[model samples]
Target: MAEEKPLTVVTCTAPVNIAVIKYWGKRDEELILPINSSLSVTLHQDQLKTTTTAAISRDFKEDRLWLNGEEADVGHPRLQSCLREMRRLARKRRGGSAGAAAPLSLAYKVHVASVNNFPTAAGLASSAAGYACLVHTLARLYGVEGELSEVARQGSGSACRSMLGGFVQWLMGERPDGKDSIAQQVAPETHWPELRVLILVVSAEKKPVGSTAGMQTSVDTSLLLKHRAEAVVPERMAQMIQFIQQRDFEGFGQLTMKDSNQFHATCLDTFPPIFYLNDVSRRIIALAHRFNAHHGKTKVAYTFDAGPNAVVFTLADTVEEFVEVVKCSFPPESNGDQFLKGLPARPASLSKELLSAVVLEPVPGAIRYILLTKPGPGPQPLDDPNLHLLGADGLPCPRA
Candidate 1:
C-alpha cells in the first residue's frame, strides 16, 4: 500500500476594511464588479479580523467548510467561485511547466474553517475580510502567487480591497470581462501614522437588508444612485485620494462625511426606501457635526455602511477628547473600563464651554462599545501550529 501523504495545513488572517468612498451597486453581479470605484482603509487585524485554516488531504472524502464554529454549506455559489478559481489557477501553473508532474495535493479535497473576532454581516464589512482570508489562505496552500485581487473580488466586491494593506482603491474598469477592475494600494499603513478609527457598535445584530440585495434594489430603482455613480463619485474619488496623499485632515474629513451622507441619501431615494440608520445612528451623526462645529473646524467625521453602526475617523490628538464626548452623549451601562476595546485611550476632560456648545440629552447604553483601531496591513500568514482552526483530522477544533 502507498504511504499516506502528510496533511498540509495553512492558517492566515485578513483585516476588515471600512469604505470611506463606499461601493454601493454592482455593475456585474456574477463577477462582483462595482458600478463605481470605491476606496477604503484597512483596519488593524489585532482588533477586527477573520482567521481561517485550510487543509488538504487525499484521505478526505469531500470539501467542507465551518464558519464561526458551525457547519456551513460548502456549495455556496460565492464560496464555490473562490474555490474553483483557485484550483483553476493552480492547475494552469502546473500545466505551464514542461515535463513537470502536477502535485498530488492538487487533486486532494480541502477542509476550511473560518472565524471572525468581530461581528459578522452587521455592515462592518465582515464578508470583505472573510472572503479575502479564504482566497489568501488558498493561495499559500496551493503555492500560487502573483495578483489575486481579481479572484477575491469574485467572492465579495470589496474583498479585493482587503487583499492589500493601508488605503486601497477598487477601480471600476470599463470592460466587459472585469479584467481591469482590481484593487490597488493608494498608500501604505505607515503613510499616515496619526490617523485613527473608532467603530461605535450601536448594535451587533445582522442587518435586515443584506448589502447584495440592497444594492440590486438601489440600482434598479434609485435614479440618484445613477447620477452619483456617473457624476458625483468620480470627482469625490479623485479629491479623497489627494487629501490622503497630502495628509489634509480637514479636506479628508469633510469629503468623507459628504460622501457617506450622499451614499445614504441614494438609499433613501430608492423607491419604497431603505433605512440603514436608526435614531441612535442619526444622533451619533449629529454629535459628530456638533463636536466639529464647537471647535470651529472638522475634528471628527462619521460614516455608516449598510447598518446602524457608525465608524468615526479622527487624528491621534483628537481621539481621546472625541471619545470622552461620545461617553458624555451616550453613557455606558456597563463599567467604563469595559466600554472601550482594542487600543488604549487615555481619559480626557471636556471643557465647560465646549460641552455647552454641543449639548445633547445623554442616552445610556445606546452604544454597545467602541473599537479603537487604525490603518493596518492586509492578509498575513500564520506559522504557529496551535493557531490552526482545524484539527489534524481536517475538522473544526472544539472551542475551549
Candidate 2:
C-alpha cells in the first residue's frame, strides 16, 4: 500500500541482419517459430539500424506506439505479444503474485517510439532491428534479464537473430510452445577482420509484398517451400556454419548465392507468386557471377532479402576493386557523390578487361545509394537521458 515510482524510461538500438541460409516459412504463426533453421550476419548499427524507447507512467491510460514519426495501432498482435511476454517475465522475476497485486501499476500502460535509420519494410531487416531494440529497452526498464531473443522472436521471427552479434543462427526447435526456438551466435563480431559487406540500396520505395505476408503465402501454397524447409535448409545450415568457421570464402559464397536463388524460387512457386526482386536485382546477380568467373574463384557473393536491394559480401583486400565494378555497371545519375556511405571505400581502377568481361546493361539511377558496413555488436543502451524518444508526458517527442 505504498507509493510507486513512475515515468520510467529507457532507450536502445539494434542492428539489422541479412539471412544467408534464408528463413522462408513459419511453423507456428503465433509463436513466430520458423519452419527451418537459418543463419545470418548482423550488420553494424552505424550503417543500418532501429532505435526505440519505452516509457511507463502511472498516469498513462493506455498503450500507444509511434513508428517512423507516425502513430501506429497499439493493438497489433505481434507488438502485444512482445509487450506481454516482457511484462510476464518482469512480474515473474519480481516474485509473481506479490508484484502483480501491488499498489504499483504493474499493469501500467506504456508509450513506445521506434524509428529506423534505414528504409522501413525494404527487406533490410527493419522489423528485426525494431523488435529487438524494443524488447531489449523494455527489459532494461522492467529489470527483466536472461535470454531476451525469445521475447524478440514473438515480435518477428528473424528479430530473434538480431539479439546477438556477428554470425547468428535461429534453430527451429521442436517444442510446441517454442521455448527452444532461440538464436545462438555462431561467432563474435571480430571473428573475421577481413570480411566486408556492401549494401546496394536499389530503392527506398515500399515493397509490394512484405516478408510477413509473402512468407505466409509460401507456407500455405508453395510445395518448394515445404521441400526447402524439410530437405534443403538443414544441410545448408550446417555447411554454411562450417564455411564461416573455416573462413572458406568460396564455399560460403556459393551457398549464399544458391540459398538466395532458392528462396526466390519458393516465392515464385507460391500460388500467386511474390516478386521481391526487379531488373536491377537480376542484373546485380549476373554481375556477381561474371565478376567471380573473371577472377576464376569466388571472390564476391550477392544475396537478396525480400527486396530489390542486393547485399554483397567480399574480403577487404578486393572490396575496393569490386566496388569499382559496381560503379561502372550502375552509375548514379545525380547526386552521385552520396552513392556510398558507412566505411570509406577508396577508389580502385576498373580496366576495360574487367568491364568487358562483365556484360550488364548500364542502368543509371537504378540504385539510391550504397551502405558499406560489416558485423557489429548486439543491442546497446544509450547513456544519455536526452536521447530518450518519449517526452515527460509519456508521448513521443516532436521528432519521435
lDDT (Cα atoms) of all candidates against the true structure = 0.93, 0.89
Model 2 CA deviation exceeding 4 Å by range = 1-6, 96-104
Q: On a 0 to 1 TM-score scale, where does candidate 2 land against the true structure?
A: 0.96
How do the residues 1-400 of candidate 2 rate in per-residue lDDT, one tens digit apiece? 3226558788999999999999878888889889999999999988888989988888888999999889999999999999899888877877854535432356888899998988998778888999999999898888788999989999989999999999999999999999999999999889988889999999888899988899999999999999999999999999999999998999999999999999999999998999999989999999999999998999999999999999999999988988788888888888877888899988988878888998567888877888889889899998687988888887888877
lDDT for 206 in candidate 1 is 95
- Candidate 2 has an lDDT of 0.89
Each candidate's number of clashing pairs is 0, 0
lDDT of 1 by residue, 26-54 (tens): 98999988999999999999999999999
User: Judged by lDDT, which candidate is best?
Assistant: 1
Question: How far out, in Å, is residue 127 in model 1?
Answer: 0.2
True-structure Cα RMSD, model 2: 2.2
lDDT of 2 at 75: 94
What CA RMSD would you report for each candidate? 1.7, 2.2
